[model samples]
Target: MSARLYVGLMSGTSMDGIDCALARCDERGTTLLATYEHPIPPATKQRIVEISRPGDNEIERMGALDRELGHLFAKATLSLLSKEQVPSTEICAIGSHGQTIRHHPPSSHQPSEQGFTLQIGDPNTIAQSTGITTVADFRRRDIAVGGEGAPLAPAFHAAAFAKAGHTRAIVNIGGIANVSLLHSEGQVLGFDTGPGNTLLDHWINRQLGQAYDKDGQWSAAGSIRPDLLARLLEHDYLSQSGPRSTGKEVFNLAWLDECLADLSSPATPQEVQSTLAEFSAESIARGIAQCEVPVSEVYVCGGGARNSDLMRRLAAKLGTATLETTASLGIEPEWVEAAAFAWLAWRSMAQLAGNIPAVTGAQEEVILGGIYPGARPRTQ
Candidate 1:
């Protein structure tokens, strides 16, 4: 089979910036050829945080950000290609996951119509600016067909990381953590485990005026408070089972404050951050443990893979299972998600099913995303 190039753009829940990747995708799978991290301006990130919830002038704020974000995505794509010295003409397509501001999957078995998700970086702008077919709005099609429309990367994980005769769980610790269970017997499952780094990120940002904990050094310095950990673990989201998804909407600062208020004693800022780390590790480990198959190895990816303290906590809880990053599978931890969107773009262009029904709780398999045609290359 002939291999073709594709680009993937993802900002994720962290809003750190855009992660743009150029990949070579074929029938077997996609290989990340190069990656670039384009930082989002502080003010733009702040606007994203505010609009994540609700605020006055919502339409106007979102409207402006939508166009601006598209330009950023376009620029990121061009920069990555330039860094690799690859021509846009060589790429088959671009998959832009955009920035997710709100995600509300139906709480129950209500019709898919009841749930909606919004990820806003304009594909039209990308198609026009980059001169490559763009596939965006990847989730809504799955949602329309009664799917959770998330953890989409699990399908890619099963192909790239799954080991024959070994049950491995891929835990993606973004702002919200989700797991992909690849059983030894050929069954795959996935769901959101609960909070990931969002709570710790928010808690630390509130106390220290920093963007992030920088490898979780602050949390490592403080002791994990038992009471706070217990209180956080009691959340209803963590207790749920089966195909599910979550985002900043459900796990944010306000909810964190409410949990703190329920604590009998006030937990110091650093203590809260420490407990949040344990909180994330426990939830992720618990989710992996609850799956039908016994997981033999656990691979950590996304932003949390870089956190040494979080990795230590996760390793302690995994017991006998091995804990490692996606790098062991030939791709870097941070690049995994972006690589997924690139694979998805390949699937989209080929008119193939991208979502796994078993993982997403979708009624049936469907081709995800809408494509926008790009300007044809001039014949020279």
Candidate 2:
């Protein structure tokens, strides 16, 4: 049988860039063919952050961003193909997760109502620009079936990391942190642990004008002020159970300011950043302990994994040896999310159910993603 190829594109909460991955997948499994990261233009990034929580002009700006991002995503794919020498026609489809603006999980008052989630990207434009069939909007169906419609990485994590006898937790420390706990008994549990680098990133950027902590060097140079850490953890979301989700809506710069106000001594901005990193490590460790299943090891991924201070804090708090990344297990950390969309697209094409009912709380298994055919001829 010939190899089947698909391109996967992901723009995570970090608002860092567009990650594109080409994969060869078959009945056996999937393998990464080529991967590239296309940074979001500074202006575009600022626009996205502004519209994340929009006003009356939201509709107009959202439409514009969708088209803009679609073209950027297509460009990323084309660039990858050129660098890898792969013909576009060789790929079966392009799976784009788009950009998530909002995620509202089902609540007690609205038990009967399905949760709502939104991702904006013009799939039609992506197809037209790349000449490859595109599959996008992979979250609504799970939400419609009563799921939280997020932390969707667990299904893919299970496929990539689930072991027969060992229990493990895959922690993705993006702008937000989420964990997928896979057990020997075949039980998989996942949810947003809380703020990861989001709060720290915003605080540092505001205080130091740096986009990120840069291996958490500044954070390492400072101390974790206990009082500030206590205040930051007071939010109710920290105590929330699994199947819960959160984003910038609940944990943004404003939230940080409120927490900061409760502090008596004004520590240096670097110290505050250190405290925030500790907050992330503590929250993640606490969340993992709450899981019913035992986790023998923690595999860290996403941009956060590269931060030495963050990883050191995480290992110390969790009392587990930190593993390198999914790459060590044959899948690169950067490509994990992108590869997931590729898997989702393949499942959609096969008409197979993708979402895990237990993880998402969906009423039942459902096939995720909507397909957009390219203008070119379809291959049999």
- Cα lDDT tens digits for candidate 2, 1-380: 14489888999878888988888766668788788988899998887887787577888899999899888888888888878888788888888999888776674227566557888878999899888999999989888887888878898888878888978888988989998888878899888889999988898889889889999999989988989988888889988776777788888888888888877878788888999999999988887887676577788878898889998888887765455667677886767888888887888877888888777778898989899997673222
Q: After superposition, how far is residue 191 of candidate 2 from its true place, in Å?
A: 0.6
Work out the TM-score per prediction.
0.96, 0.95
- Among all windows of 10 consecutive residues in model 2, the one with the lowest summed lDDT is 106-115
Q: Quote model 1's TM-score.
A: 0.96
Q: Poorest 10 consecutive residues of model 1 by lDDT?
A: 105-114
Error of 2 at 44 (Å): 0.9
TM-score of 2: 0.95
lDDT of every predicted structure (CA atoms): 0.87, 0.84
Number of the top TM-score candidate: 1
RMSD of each: 2.1, 2.3
